[model samples]
Target: MSDPKTEEDIFAEVDAEIAAEEEAAAAEMDEPIGPSDSAVDGPGAGVDALVAERDELQDRLMRALAEAENIRKRGERDRREAEQYGGSKLARDMLPVFDNLRRALDAIDEPSRDVAGGVIEGVELTLRELLNVFGKHGIRPIAPEVGDVFDPQLHQAMFEAPVPNVPKGCIVQVMVEGFELHDRLLRPAQVGVSSTPAS
Candidate 1:
């Protein structure tokens, strides 16, 4: 009051107040006051918290997008498989009719083919049309010829026999033709194979 406080005294008083406030804060937090700790209380703290939240949200959004893409790709693959193989059962059932048609033609011997020429021609036409349809639909016949190497994957051995001049494991006769749908085997060709050659 007698003399206005000197600049030095004024600064000392302000510093004391700030130190007291810091002491109280440190006491409440159970830690020592430091420059770095003080910085965490200002406007910068809100910005840091907001930045952390933004990063977490961004991570979650990215993960969700990746999961959605994977689900879409899986669904597309399932749809394609269903489209390609949906008629497998129907195609399997129709094979018997094809076999019957083949039997009908084979029953007509060459000696009587001329006598029943018109009927035989009609049957032949039907067989040709059926085969054409089979080809168009990705169904192919596996008609292994005699002397072809026997393939266990594509042929079923009906029996094995020794044959002169024929290599072992070669086809001796094709008992029945097989069929395939796309890359899958609908039926394996039935065949007889040559046994091991005599020593």
Candidate 2:
């Protein structure tokens, strides 16, 4: 019959196996625990990666902030423009009505106007009221007087005239008055500019 193993012997064998496992574990720890790549080479490897990531994130954040600011500024500009030029088209359309009224008043001579006093007074009153309304709404005529300096921005020359005493590039006559709404011009004045004398 085979002899049975002693308890002490079994315990010593178990202890030896435990010691071997500890040695193997120690060897594994001494070798290296993670991937043997450059990430574990030195402190600089991890630090560089972290710094690059931080810089990339910072750049992205700055770009996002700049884009947000640009959008806000664009919205503000559009709103201001809309408010400033809101009545431009309608104001422009009504200018012809004013022109016809002026034409009707001009067509009547003084004798005829005196003959029809009531009709003339009614038309004049209407013109005065219309002008008052135009003043209230910031609409004004750009009727330059004769001998005034010609402005290309405000005047459109209908014909050139060589006046005897008027300076060259000066207004010789205003054929049709212009109109403006606030600082913007609705139409440029039809004018006659003095010409330079021939050499």
The segments of candidate 1 whose C-alpha lies over 4 angstroms from its true place after superposition are 1-43
List runs of model 2 lying over 4 Å from the truth. 1-32, 35-48, 196-199
Candidate 1 residues 1-199, lDDT tens each? Answer: 5985654565466556555655564465565558786676763454455456556755675686679789999999999878877778988898888889898988889878979899899989998999999888889999999999999999999999989888899999997889999998998999999998766
Top-TM-score structure, candidate number: 1
What lDDT does candidate 1 reach at residue 156? 99
* Ten residues in sequence with the least summed lDDT for candidate 1: 42-51
Structure candidate 2, residue pairs in collision: none
Q: Please name the candidate that would achieve the greatest lDDT relative to the true structure.
A: 1
lDDT value, candidate 2, whole model: 0.79
Per-residue lDDT tens digits of candidate 2, residues 63-173?
A: 866797899999999998788678889888888888888888889998998799899888888888988888887889898999899999999999997778777999988
lDDT (0-100) at residue 127 of candidate 1?
89
Task: Count the clashes in each prediction.
Answer: 0, 0
